[model samples]
Target: MTGSRKSADALGEAETIALRVLGFIASTEDLFDVFVNASGVSADHVPTLAEDPEFLAAVLDFLLMDDRWVIDFAKAEGIAPEVVMQARAGLPGGDLPNWT
Candidate 1:
């Protein structure tokens, strides 16, 4: 039960990050345009694509590209900087780092 619940929480976190990623993208024309061009996501499809975990993961990955952007988004969204990292771990490529 605990493991399942934790899995649910992780999925929930990914969705939350998805929403914030949309919000962050919509706030900046340049960023939005860049995402659209690179992701091949048409503005018309945003409402649909935003719900996808893979799409959400892509958004997180996009944000992770730049520290300044990540910081800005965290500040605007009122979430801790670490929350983004946590959310990332819920995605396909988001394994915990092996800091040996």
Candidate 2:
């Protein structure tokens, strides 16, 4: 079905974006250390964890916590900052129900 195909494409795009974010984080020592500490994920295990959509969502969550980080990342990746949020939404468990 077209809908399912679209969903799969979205998932693939999200995963690619998340992997880019992971690379961005790993690009700097300070950022990498902070992410590893905050995530409680061993540096050696990042490759394994990167395969999980939930973990990728968390990576986006972490990136969203700081506007400067988002700007910098977006600029570095030559993408609009809004794309990060869109990618996050495409990931698993990204649709949190609104309580309002």
TM-score of each: 0.85, 0.93
Off by over 4 Å in 1: 96-100
Query: lDDT of each prediction vs. the true structure?
Result: 0.82, 0.91
lDDT of 1: 0.82
Runs off by more than 4 Å, candidate 2: 97-100
Pairs of residues at least 3 apart in sequence or in different chains that clash in candidate 1 = none
Q: Each prediction's Cα RMSD?
A: 2.5, 1.7
lDDT per residue as tens, model 1, 26-59: 7875998888887888889988888788788888
lDDT of 2: 0.91
Report the number of clashing residue pairs per model: 0, 0
lDDT at 27 for candidate 2?
A: 99
